[model samples]
Target: MGFSKLFIFLFILQTLLAMALTQPTDQKTNIFREYIGSVSNNVTFADVPINPNVEFHYILAFAIDYTTSSSPHPTDGKFDVFWDTHNFSPSEVTAIKNQHSNVKVALSLGGDSVKKEKCYFSPFSVDSWVSNAVSSLTKIIKEYNLDGIDIDYEQFHADPEIFAKCIGKLITTLKNNGVISFASIAPFDDDEVQSHYLALWKSYGDIIDYVNFQFYAYDKGTTVYQFMNYFHMQSSNYEGGNILVSLTTEGRGGLSPENGFFKACDMLKSEGKLNGIFVWSADTSKGLGFRYEEQSQALLAVSHLHSLV
Candidate 1:
């Protein structure tokens, strides 16, 4: 082969190799999985392995607890970050990230258990629970080379004002320190979490990178119109970048991946109103055979390609 032809062939080979190694980010699809609640029976992290064909913007680890009055984190600003291996393990995390080199391995903080007042909006405090949560979060992000943090504070009943302050300050700190590339919230269709987020966005929306808004759990019998309508309603509160259309696996049924769920996603993608899809869980879905892990990426990819045309 001539030198010029040889150069072209080598370049093509290198490009193909790069594609096999990592996922493309720009003008591509975004899919996320939340490792929350419980994984399916006998389904270990290795059970539902990362599909090389799929690319994920985030694979959120279900959660880490906050230092509460009952279960305090650490006063000396040290946090273990991991325990009860069921939630996560080091090797499992590595495997997930290795699939998509740019995949953001984020940690979800809080759930039904995290107490606000008891922890002073923990992630924002210092030398106390703040130290505990932040220090631990720092440790994990570095240790695992994780990407970001997602706040899944389920206690919307708490003061939205306090919640907003905590959220605003926390994201600001995380982004400023360059410890996390993104920060997100997992909120539902109610005014509880919404109110707090609204308060935060009123002044500090820039700090928030995404909102994995839960479309299931609360919204029963969700139709395509209902799903789009919710997007319209929520998008008013946040920007296009912050809104991620999320669905459930083990919800009140009907609103599933193969059910009306993908239908809703299709409409959103067509209208260009979707950031991406967020599955409420990984394990439960795997157990129930509610698999859309690869489909989510494929759907988004098709949607994106159509938008270009």
Candidate 2:
């Protein structure tokens, strides 16, 4: 072949190799995550049953950028622990992880409301918010020995780009500093919320580890067919992302386990799309006897084993 032809061939090979390296895989994993501490249910880490077969994660419900005083006001970018420290303290985090070898702990940021007022992503500026967030969150993560962080800012006081820049920078800084091993964004199907998260995904998707889409936030009577379609829709929305299937123990919304959540999970598992599963909270599950938690982990474990077969 001529020199020019050889150069073209090598370029095509390198392009294919890069595409193979960058593309996301659909391999299923036996990973289960749950949000704890947000509901202030006096629930402790030990209360939840742990399945050793699955990689379990207990994500503390929230560490909001707000004050924990009586009024509970926002602090621009500064974050403070708003979780149920009475039961789920930093020490509890350490104890749980130490007890369960397959367990990891993460914290979510910006829950729905604070003191009846909406918790907005009202960062004063991207630079300042990221700086304050990094400083405050790093202290909390180190103190708790947490493994990851989740973004759950439901309401946004800023535009899409501003929200994107603030969160994108925050995740980037935390990962770069080795403060956290993984990070996730908890986005629901709302138009406004999706816009902001999509903006973040568009800009810094490579750095993001997971898209913890809140499918439970959908209407309460969602069917198995609707659930599967929703999952596919979101899979398309956040393309090439490990979107975890979610449910709420509070019976608030989405497809309840009694209504075929695990069945949907089994379907996803068969297609190798069941990357992971997470729940809205451990707080409610504690009162409900944690049967669904047991079921979820069992399904994930069985799915993992079957996948190997």
Candidate 3:
């Protein structure tokens, strides 16, 4: 009887150990991201304070697949640097990453506009566009020493399937070729945009890392209650993806930080649903002394510590 009891005890101990090892730990992946150099206000990585406790990413505003000229036009899938390269160059990226071991730099693709014209996906064909995009973006990613890519195409001339295939293939190729370690999709709540991104999410949700939903693109004066509802909606739409909370430094729209944005975040964190926070444009933030940026990092840092305990 004692031998049988000892055997049972050992089995129970092993099962308990496995359960403990498998429990989820989210503290390591908590992140704080910001977009910079989009407005050309001379904002560099050094201008933003880096918090050592949180995983921080500096997204270079845009590397649009368009020609650079007085009147820019799309070049099928070829990308050119549209951000403030003089202020945020390859050397600067290296310097910042070297300075902060937790820092990573990624480039955004297909922003809202290029030289006043609406930027569209406008790919000739999925195969050709993927080919050109892979080649051109590989060059730019290498040149900038970037770690990832964020899709921010605001408009699309192509159909939803075409957009999905083109982007899904591009991200797959980049990851397989070891070009990028992470990829994200930025989609707001517009009907057309939703259709296209939802198609992509359905097909490639396993590969995409974060849904940087433009929460700030919503109407101004959003209440904390409404914000929480919207968060649940997008979380359901994207399903298992990490839906990050956002606010623009421009205060152009969405839930303003001064008006209880952090309070909503606290609620999500308490529920273990808060993934991360991203701010729009570090350019406008410089004038505000980056108070919101500091607050965001501090929140993530504190949450990380709490998770450890």
Candidate 4:
């Protein structure tokens, strides 16, 4: 072959070989970019973009107490009656489903005030309460197509054993029909309550997908030190699987997302035992309540932690 032809041939061969080696790496990079783009686009009021590599604890189905006394009450104006007909708006529920497809949104049944009234009846009660609850929830699921249900039966403090049985029944029924179930539990600080908590956990573990610890009420402070102490204590005590550490972004002495909340999440990630993070209510942020941008930064901060894996 001529010298010029030989030189051209060698150069072309080298270029082809280099392109072949780099193709897979370049394709992977592109795929990752696309995946991240898809996730970012999916951000909504209910969920923030989580790192695809890390499995996030379930994003709480931001709850609004639809009972009688809530700001926007149903026409009947009775807590139980109102709950039967009124629930979250279709748009609000849609926002949750769109934002976090993989995450579960458990409809929290009761709130602090709801518990005070002793409104929750036994799970075995043949009263209209269970039927009403199930019907209301079914409407929500059908309308918003929620991933799961969260029974926040705070009223059950008086008779938690019976309450637990009721909750277990509800959970079993939901799971058998292919729905997820989560239970939002009070803090287990006292020895007596700790025993009850353990019993409930043991009994409901099969039916309950996860337990969200109301960590904020127990650990009210402005610093990471206080939050961490509370978190560690709870983790040490509760040796259960998929225990989610929760905090409130609003309400009495709640932690702001920018404050120690993100730091606490990082701390949990470092420990290699973090399941997920839950914000109390989406309706109660400082300025832009539950909007994507306001919550996005907080989620991004959690996603950035290298130790999340």
Best by TM-score: 3
Ranking of all predicted structures according to lDDT, beginning with the best and ending with the worst: 3, 2, 1, 4
Residue by residue across 11-66, what tens digits does model 3's lDDT show?
87777555433332343346889999888777789999877777888898899888
Give me the displacement of residue 110 in model 1, in angstroms: 0.5
Q: Rank all candidate structures by their TM-score, best first, as comma-separated numbers.
A: 3, 2, 1, 4
Tens digit per residue, CA lDDT, model 2, 1-309: 999999998997777555433322222477788898887767888989988778888899789888756243577788888888888777888888788777889999999987687898887778898899999999999998999999999988899999999989989899999999889999999999999999999998888888889999999999999999999999998888889999999889999988999999989988889988898788888888999999988888776655544
Error of 4 at 160 (Å): 2.5
Every model's TM-score: 0.76, 0.88, 0.90, 0.60
Cα lDDT over the full model 1: 0.61
Pull out the clashing pairs in model 3.
none
lDDT over C-alpha atoms for residue 169 of model 3: 96
Question: Where is model 2 poorest over a 10-residue stretch in terms of lDDT?
Answer: 19-28
- Write down the worst ten-residue block by lDDT for model 3: 19-28
What are the per-residue Cα lDDT tens digits for candidate 4 across 193-296? 56556666667765555556676656445577777776677766655545555555454553455566766766766676556555554434323444432343
- Which candidate, 3 or 4, would have the higher TM-score against the true structure? 3
Q: After superposition, how far is residue 167 of candidate 1 from its true place, in Å?
A: 2.0
Candidate 1 contains a number of clashing pairs equal to: 1
Runs in model 4 deviating more than 4 A are 1-87, 95-104, 114-136, 181-197, 254-259, 286-309
Q: Cα deviation of 294 in candidate 3 (Å)?
A: 0.5
Candidate models: Cα lDDT each: 0.61, 0.86, 0.88, 0.46
How many clashing residue pairs, candidate 4? 2
